[model samples]
Target: MTNKKQRLASVDALRGFDMFWIIGGEALFAPLLALTGWSLFAFGHEQMQHSQWHGFRFYDLIFPLFIFLSGVTLGIANKSLQGLPLENRWPVYRKAIKRLLILIGLGIVYNHGWGSGIPADLSEIRYASVLARIGFAWFFAAMIVWHFGPRAQYAIAAAILLGYWLLQVGFGPLTPADSVNSWLDQCCLPGITYLNRPYDPEGLLSTLPSIVNALVGVFAGRWLRQKAGQHTNILVGLAAGGLACLLVGLLWHRVYPINKELWTGSFVLITSACSLLLLALFYLLVDRWQWRYFNYFFAVIGCNAILVYLGTSLVNWQYSSNSLFGGIAAALPDAAGTLVIACGVLLLQWLVLRWLYRREIFISP
Candidate 1:
């Protein structure tokens, strides 16, 4: 395959890897602790869950990672459209807006995508969601790059990070109930939030900084697309960039605090750094080394990422798999056997995507 295609595949593989965690691949280990009665496995299982309010964990990285990937993909897409006349690029913006609407609808559906159906009250709205955040963040980043180009994209990202930090500083200290972020959010929208909490982690105000994560991703995509031919420099630069961002995040945490709920400037730096390094790792394997087969599974899921995400949400995949694979798991003598159920569900998810992959069916945007 061509180098450009390889770069794109790497992005898909990285995305598939991220989706794997969301679609229950991470849950495979949760049952291990009960099966083996081991504290270590128990600790491992706990990591699958999100950190309550402060700090970070593997699960916390999923949304931001995907956000970063969306930005990167947008960057790649933008570059590909460079030769088109300005008038011809209207479709790009049109498609973006349409996708944003679709994603917003999907996010609402995902939250209320239950058997009970949508609630009647507008108060029932869950304004903050994974899909909505991705939509808004990606939309803004793309528009910035489209209108102002890369130079301004970088400037805007930096301004967001700095401005958000300054906002927190100006707000000063805040208790959870009276937290500035949450309070401002509630004041804007009376009854819309995530998990009915005073402050939604995916709230409006916090999404400002999350845009930086995607914009940074635009730069990463640019590097990979523009400099993939220079393998050594890009790889080394990526590593150095990741480390530098991490260092900055750690140091800045002293002031702003690296809170995922807040999507704090520090949190954006730390998560974006991790996303870049992780992408580098995947790109190294799939692009640099040409280890194509290794990423086949990830590529499969990534290709149909949105479709599979919806499948996991809409269907009772876990229940169905337990009916079939629960026996296999039960037959096992060890506690790890319980994981067979989750593995079964994950397998089912992959099979669905695999079928789509075979037919070149990609439900993106």
Candidate 2:
């Protein structure tokens, strides 16, 4: 429940770590495996990227974890709000709403465009997106946290996941390829269903479970903010929560199948657990151990994550890559454009974040 000034370094580090993957694939270990003649689309890499209709993968866990972390941060933010009088809550609420709106607007702008050569068909524009889902989930969860206490918020989150699971299993129709859940996505999302080409990673129906993920973090955040030794509390909470998630996810996987696209109850459990574990690990290493160097790089990127994503999407980094290291890569022979683009994007985002950080300007949602 610490204020912005008292925010934990571990949270920032974790946020930065999450953004590293999203900003570019190369910064992560995935590209290394791919470079070693392992096809990211073959075997596990494809699974890591996403499940086709059903099943789970390491990559599927990433987005939900981020949402969960956001929820945790919300709890912390809420605690900080306690010192402010009742009169000040209105302004905080306004700020939260504005952040959500800006995130949604950015999501739309990233998908659609205000410039020439924009696709004429409105329906073709990707409506459901990652930022949109996060914004919606964060806004709703924040409202719940703001109104009801943390206990109530947790109950609401659990209800959501369980309810979604029951609905998908008990009432949803069947599909020929997978199970009823996959079919449910198509049936529920219908017109907005991601049909291929350029698809929405965060679609409409999936947002339900995503909201729960964020709420879980909210609960964690509230717990962490309690008056106690930070390290012990974080470790215990993360361990317990993560273990519970892993166990529940594994058990539920049998019936529901841990499908990322469907955002099954099991998937939510598993990802939340992973997120908790990751936060614990980061907290232990960066905060507890007082490691400074590794964090600065990620903190920079984490601070301006949204801006970095938008910049990369709007402005091409290919020219920048070519201008800097293209010739060196070309001389090496058979360098994939994907690798080059990934590297360029990482460097560009890093530099931008570093610059912004130096100016004490943080673009947060």
In order, candidate lDDTs are 0.82, 0.71
The top-ranked prediction according to lDDT is: 1
Q: Tell me how far the alpha carbon of residue 306 in candidate 2 is from the true structure, in angstroms, after superposition.
A: 1.0
List all candidate RMSDs to the true structure.
Answer: 2.5, 4.1
Determine the C-alpha RMSD for candidate 2 after optimal superposition of all C-alphas: 4.1
**Tens-place lDDT digits, model 2, residues 167-268:** 777754423334444454455543353444222347665677888888888877766776235678668877888898899889988877877766778888
lDDT of 1 by residue, 325-359 (tens): 88787788655566777788888888888888999
TM-score: model 1 vs. ground truth: 0.92
The regions of model 1 sitting more than 4 angstroms off are 34-43, 80-89, 113-119
lDDT of 1: 0.82
Worst 10 residues of 1 by lDDT: 113-122
